[model samples]
Each structure stands twice: as C-alpha cells, then as structure tokens.
Target: MTAALPRADVAPVAPAKRRRHALGWLAVVPLLVFTAIAFGLPALAVLDGAFTAKDPATGATSYTTGNLTTSLQGPYLTALLGSVKLSAVSAALGALLGLPLAQAVVGSRSRALREAVLTASGVLANFGGVPLAFAFVATLGNAGVLTVRLGLKDSGWDLYSFWGLVLVYLYFLIPLMVLTITPALEGLRSQWREAALNNGATGAQYWRHVALHVLAPSLLGGLVLLFGSAFAAYATAAAMVGSAVPLVTLQIADALSGNVLVGQENVALALSLDMVLVAGLVMAVYLPLQRRSARWLDA
Candidate 1:
C-alpha cells in the first residue's frame, strides 16, 4: 500500500511561445520609447505650460488660465479661425479632386497604370515642407520661370497669398486623399455592383444608392485626415509666405521664438493645446467613420 503512492503529472511549458512573446514585446519597446520621447513629453510640457504663467522678473511659475483666455482673444482667435478655414477649404478641394483620381486609378484595367498612379501619390503625398515650398516658389513665384514665361504675374496671381497657399497645400493634400481613398475604392465589391445592375439600377442610381453610401465614411475620414494635416502644416507656409500669413502655427512660432511679443511662450503652449484639441476632435470623428468604413470594406 505504501509503494502505491501516485505520482502527479505536469504538462511541460512551451518555451518557444514564451520566447516569441518576449521578442514581440522587445520589438515594440523602441517604438514605445520613441513615441514617449517625441510626443508624450512635449505634449505634457505644453499642457502644463498652458495652464501656468511665469513671471518675467522673478521667473516664478504660477497656475492661471490667462494663457488660454489670451489664446482665444483678438489676433490669436483670428489666426485660429484662419487656420480652420484654410484647412477646411484645402481638404474639401483635395477631396473633390482626389476622389475622381482614385476612382480613375482603381477602375483602370491596366495594373501598370494603377501602380504608376499609386507610386506618384506616395511620392507627392510626402512632397511637402521646405522642399515643396521651394518647388512651388521656383515654379510659381513672382520671378518664377513659368510665371515669367506665361505672364502670370500680369494676371495678379501672387504665390504668397491665401489662395496661393491653398494651391500649394493641395499638392500634398490631393495625393494624400488619393492614397487614403484608393483602398476604399478598391474594396467596392464587384458582386454588389452586379447585384445592383441585375436589380435594374442604372449606373448613376447604383452609385447614388450603393457605392456612395458605402464610400461616404471613407471619404469623410480621408477629408478629416487632410484637414488635420493642413491645419498642422508649418514649414511650407513659413518658407513661402513667412509672417505674411497670420496662421496659428506662425503665431505659435513667433511666441516661442520671441520673434513677436517676448515672454508670450506660455501663449504658444496654449495655442499648441488648441491645435491639439482641434486635431483630437478631427480624429474622434475620423475614427468612428474609419471603423464603419472598415466594416464594409474589409468584409
């Protein structure tokens, strides 16, 4: 009876699974660290500074809402509104142009054509900031080659004006819209189209009822993304128009760099907070639309 003691059996743990999980976490660590360093800390600093004011004489920091109040008044408000209008207009124009371009590429029978369009889009979407500003200036400025050749200056076309900025913004915005909406366009199911046709729906009716309905979410999301991109853009406008344009980004730079009124750095932080809020709101709207788009597109 004593020799009949039972031995308990235990399953062996999978070392490979544990190792793979560890590697996955390890791979993510760098990205996590980078995000915290690049975005998280700066955001925190800005938030903190937005609600706190510093005394120039004593260099003492105190909690106050003056920065926020100041940001929403006068020139700051005007700059904010200008930025909003510019972003909205540019995004709308991008959507108008990009949708047709995306459709053209998607509907094309040639794979090479599709690839070429996509490649061009990828390049142009990122063709922004200083280099883009330089390109536009060299091509469209008062003494630009084309401007001189075509006598565009005589037509009162100034490349440093509000409308000019919109055109420059569209260079990047249109391509971004194309890239964003192309996937949604491709996700349109052929069977759905066939079904609509079989049900005696004309092409226009099919688009109005089925295709547009399905594509609306993606389109709206892409527009929101473009809006945010245009809203936050700085370098292009700065390089092209300098302080000629009263953009929020320009104001922020002025405040931070002491190029405008000195000791208004806190105001810059407040401006940044406003920009973040606007961007956050855009993303909030975009996320739900993107989710809805994915529900049908990924199906």
Candidate 2:
C-alpha cells in the first residue's frame, strides 16, 4: 500500500458500525418473537382446527367440509348481507359528516378552538362499544332525555332496528374519519386555495378543482377504515340488540359457544368461513384503494 491507515480510526470505525447494526437488529427482536409466539401460533391453530373434525365417540380427527357448507345456508347469508349494508351506509355517512367537520376544524383561525375540536374528536374516536351504547341509550332510548323532554311516549324510536344500529356505528365512525382525514387536510398547501382565488375561481370551482383532488385519498381511505370497523363490530351489537339484531358478529359468537345446536365442529367451520368472507371483503376493497392512492401519489 502507498500509505498505511491509522489503527485507532479504522479499529473504532469497524467496531462502531458493527455495534450500531447489532443494536438495530436488537430493537426488532422483541417484536419478531412476540409475533411468532402470539399471533402466528394462534392463527395456525385456528386454521388446523377449522379443517379437522373431532369424532364425538373416540376423539379421532378427520377432514370434512360439512360445517363450512352449512354456514353458507340462509341464516348466515342473510346476516352477512345485513352486516355489509349497515357497514357500507355507516362509512359513507361518516365520510360525509367527517369531511365538513375536519374542514371546519382545519380552517379555524383560533388555536384554542382547533385544539378543543381535535381533542373532542380524538375522545369520541375511541369511544365506542359499551360506553357509546350507553350514551346513545341515554340520548335516544326509551325514557331517554329526548324521549322525556319531547314527551314522545310513543315516539316509535326503537334503537334495536337496523337504522338504529347505523346511527350508533356513525357515532364512532365520524370521529375516526375526522382523525384519519385531518392529516391529509393539513398537508394540503394553502397556496393552492389562494392561487385558485387569484385566478378568479369561485368557491365551488376551487373546491371541485383543488380541494377535492387533495382530499380524495384521505376520504376514501377513511371510508375503508370505517367499513372494516363497523363490519367487525361485536360489542356494540351485543350491548344494544343482543341476539335480536342477528348480525354476523353476534351469529359467530353464538356458534362458538356451547349452546349452539350445530356443535363445535360446525361452529369452527362457520367461524372459518365467516373469517374468510370478511378477509375477502377487506382485500377486495383495500386493493383498489391502495392502487388509487398510489395513482394519486404518482400524479
């Protein structure tokens, strides 16, 4: 070599680089181990159990698709359709309501009001299941505040109906959409609006041309999130309607219990079928959304 490298510099550099890599890998170790033990094992177990049938006599296991077919019959099919309709409506309503709320909050001049609105939205976003159900009961249920104050003894306000469920779902979905969409709203350059105004663009024209384009991704993404949330919901339905509503989640829960007439094998198969359907729905919606988002990014 023309000149020898300094030992102190080279030695320290190599060790330091190695140490950094080791630390980086170390940070991921806990997550990797936790995923393998907790999530991976449980999922595999469910899959294996779903496909195998246990003999009620000798406890022998064998493969069968009888339970899977039974799950596809009328009752489960009806529940699936109902769940889809309810969730779709909820997500749509959430986006419609949320977009304006987010706009208002983002457009505010006062910092205190903005912070207060954001804080309230965040609280409501996490406020679903039992607490939300109770809140609704207090507001709109029998002997509720509205009921008593309006003297609507026979107001025909039944919270056990399908529309009632949609209303409850929206209570949670709106806040979530606001939380998700607000970031994208914030990321939008203010100059775009100012530029449009400078060019003699009216309010409607500016919103149509500039604001809508920027917000489309966040809006659709928010709808997808709301759909998944309402689709997979169990607690709200259980607390509110119980078995009377006949939602998929409630049906799945019923099948899993010991009281079901179809037995555990059938229950397992039904659960697997339900899971596959839900997973398929999510992928069907999510793949197109991802592609759209990517297109927007490219543009």
Candidate 3:
C-alpha cells in the first residue's frame, strides 16, 4: 500500500495556527515599537553614555567605569542618599496615614462615600507637578494666602524647606497609598473575623495573627510603590524647591544642562542609570510580594 498521506485538514491546521499566532503578534507590534522608541532606545542611550567618557581636548570618546565611580563620590553620593532618605521617609509617612484612611474607606457603610473617596484619591494622586507646586505655593508659600494670614513665616516655618517638601509630597503620597491599599483592605473577609471570634479569639489576636499577616505583603508592596514614586518625582520638586534642594533629580537636570558643572553629561547618564537600578530593585521586591498578596486577595 502507498504510505498514508497526512490528512488534508491536519496539513492546513498547522498553517492556520501559525497564521493566528502571526496575527496575535501583529496586534502587539505597535506596543513593542512604541516601547522601543519611548523607553528602550532612551535606556540604551543612557546605558551607553554611562560607560563612555569623552576627552575635552581630543574630542574622542572611550568606554570607562569612571562615570560610575564619579557618580558614587561627593555631592553625587550625597544627592543619591538624600533621594533615598526622602523616598523612605515619605513612603513611611504615607503608609502610616494611608492605612487608617484605607481601612476607614473600606469599612464605610455608604457606597457613595467609598466611591467618592476612591474617585478623589485617583484625582489627587495624579494632581502633582507644576500646578501642584503652584497650588501649594499659593496656599503655603511666603506670600501664600495661608502663610500671610497665619503669619507662619514668623513662626520659623519656611515652605521651601526639607520638611516643607515632605509636606507637599504627602498631599499626593497619601492619596496614592489610599488608592493602592484600598483593594487589599477590601480583600479582607468578614468571615475571617467572625471565625476568629467564634474560636474565642480577641480582635487584637485576630489582627495580629490573621489580618496583619495576610495584609503585610500588600502593605509592603504599597510602600515600595510610594517609595519609587517619591524617588523619581522631578517636576514638583523642581518647581517647589528649585536648586535649593540637593536632590539627585535636580543634580541630573543640572548636569544635563551643563549649568552646575560642564562636561558632566556622562555623570548625569550614570545617575539616570543609578535611578533605574533603584527603581528596578524596588519593583523586584514588590512584584513577588504583590503576587503572593494577590493569591489570597483574589481567593
């Protein structure tokens, strides 16, 4: 007998699947191209420049680790540390304030109240940058309405100070914390509490053993997000504090513009690389915890 031929249907099935796969990929092409142009290419350029140094006299370029080393020294190091400190402090503060607010919102009896808070949080979380700076300045600055009326400047309060920056940061940070942690808070089931109570467990015991334990991962994830947000923020800080603050973002801007020190463009790129690494590390820690938290929350 002749060798059995593959079924006609089977022969077309492979090509059909291949065509479907190609079409699926075609749908993603626009996104991939956009990412490459907006993020990938710029990131590659930063990475390339961070490792390359140019000679002023010869106008020649060479690869070196000098930029990385320079980034870790003196003012650069200080700015990096400051950025870390600011991010950590602001994140902590946001968590402290937001946890209670989120719990309040989640526990509220009225659906309207919950929706209102969430809607407000969403708006306020994105209400940063120059307009936010202007609003704060108008409300709390030296000549601001509140400051002028309260005479707070005479009380040794300056809106341009570090603590002032923290206060301004809180305006958005708290709302961000609320938006992130609200869903996690809502994930907590009433049955868990009832079960604990039926088992003769106190409220404190339930929270200590069950609630907090389950919520810990999500809380940490929210903090990580807030930290990253604070760390990468540039416009608000730029508008509110200008060069008065020694932030890494400001230093990067100064270096890139050749305003603070000329020939430090590579150093700025190195700083940018440093920021990417920091943000990457935060997300690295966040993602696994977020995944673990989601498992329980979704259940």
Candidate 4:
C-alpha cells in the first residue's frame, strides 16, 4: 500500500522565529569554542596523562592505572584529605559569617552603605593568591604587626599552619559568599515580613520560619560555591604555607617538580584528575541548588 499522504495543512514555524532561533544558537558558538579550548582540551590532556606512564630506560610510553593507584595510596591521600578538611571548614565559616553580613546589607537603610559593602565584597572576592598570601603573612605572620602588637607569637599562633591557611582562605571566601548570597537575600520579599508581623509573628519567628525556608537553597548553593573555590585554590595556599600545608594542589606541584620522586608527572595529573572530580561533584550539587533558588526568587 502507498504511504499516507503528507498533511499539507500543517503549519511551519515562522521564518522570523526560525531565523531568531538560528541566531540564538549561532550566538553560543563562541562560548562553545572557548569551552572546548579552555576546559575540554585541558581535561583531555589530564585524563590522558593520568592513565599513562613512560618507561625511563626505554623511553616507551604505556597506558596503565598505576598513577591513579599510587595517587590514592600514600602521602597523596593525606594531601587530598587535608584539602577536603580545609575546604569544608573555610566554606562553613564563610557561609556562617557571610550570610548575616549579606542580610544586614540587604536590610540596611543606607543605600550608599549597601553599595559600598557590595563593591568591597566584589573586589575582595577576587583579591586572592600571592598578594593575599603576602598581606596575610605581613599582618598575621610571626613578626606581623598585629602579631607583634597582640603578642600572637607568644600565644602560639602561627600563620603558616593549617588553621592559619584556613584563616587566609577565609579572607577571600567570606567576601565570595557575601557576593553569592546577596541577591538571594534581596529576593526575600518585604510583603512576607509584613504579613508575618500582621499575624503576630515576631521578627525572629519570621526569619526562622519564613525567610530561612525560602533562602535555604540559595544558602546551600553559595556554600557549595565557597567549598569549590577553596578546594580548587592553588596559588594562595602554595604561597601561604608551601609544603607546610598538606594540600592536594601543593602535592600536584611537588609531583610535577619530582620533589619526592623522579618521573611522577603522571601522578601529578592523577591528582589533578581527583581535584577535577571533586570540583565536578561540588558543581553538580551547586547547579541544581542554584536553579532551585532562582525559581524561588522569581516566585
């Protein structure tokens, strides 16, 4: 039997709309190209290096999982765990401190003050790495001005220690959290507060039951962002504590430099693979929470 005739009455998408859609997709080409070059190629390189090794005597290359296995087995494991702990602590503290600061900024009567705080936060969030490390060391290091004035050295406060590195991480992390959570704070409607008050809900109750509930997703997303930021950090921690801090980033650098053992560059790439996985997992959690928060905010 002959196939059924085509539906001649079917409507086609408008040519204008079709052109607009094509343009939209075309507009994304640059971003896709940038991602391919910036992230994709680098990722492929890391994966390739991570699962392969070169024979020193014969100079022959072969694929193997030994790099990953070795990465997870020894001091490498300690560095990974240390980075996780530092990221967790710093992210938690940043969220805790930054949330209230953002709230205060959002609730302030002074517009100038709000803008100033936000601008400062924007600046400070990007203010990290070697300069940040140097600043912290000068201000909080053993012979730092504050250290000398406060006698922190006598108090056993060391700026090159794990906790001191965490404290340095906070310098950027808190500002980052403030910037991240500010928009979420502003999205909390004033009408909700008024209605809660009209119903005899105290200020604390309104925040506890109403505002906090709405802001939870955003807060968690911001926390995750803070976590990823701290986790992937390299320069600041490297500059601040060097080998004193048992961090994955530093370990990667060490492996690349063959500081501990010769011909372990593949192990460095494996460590990088581990870091990418951790960061990917954090972003996986963050993206969903970010979307959820945006939906609530739009509501």
Clashes of each: 0, 0, 0, 0
lDDT of 3 by residue, 1-299 (tens): 89998887778888899999999999999999999999999999999999999999999999999999999999999999989999999999999999999999999999999999999999999889999999999999999999999999999989897889999999999999999999898899999999999999999999899999999999999999999999999999999999777799999999999997899999999999999999999999999999999999888
What are the per-residue Cα lDDT tens digits for candidate 1 across 53-140?
9888998989999999999999999999999999999999999999999999999999999999999999999888999999999999
Q: Candidate 1 clash total?
A: 0
141-222 in candidate 4: lDDT tens per residue?
9889999999999989999998898899888899999899999998989999999999999999999999999999999999
Position 237, candidate 1: lDDT:
98
Instruction: Assess every candidate by TM-score.
Output: 0.91, 0.85, 0.92, 0.94
* Highest TM-score against the true fold, candidate: 4
Q: Flag the better candidate by lDDT, 2 or 3.
A: 3
The RMSD of every model to the true structure, in order and in angstroms, is: 3.5, 3.4, 2.9, 3.6
Where is model 2 more than 4 Å wrong at Cα?
Answer: 1-19, 151-155, 265-269, 280-299
Query: What is the C-alpha local distance difference test score of each model?
Result: 0.95, 0.79, 0.95, 0.93
Model 2, 11-112: lDDT tens digits are 788789999999999999999999999978877776666667778889788877756666667777677777888888999999999999998999999999
lDDT at 213, model 2: 81
Candidate 1 weakest ten by summed lDDT: 5-14
Clashing pairs in 1: none
CA deviation > 4 Å runs, candidate 1: 1-27
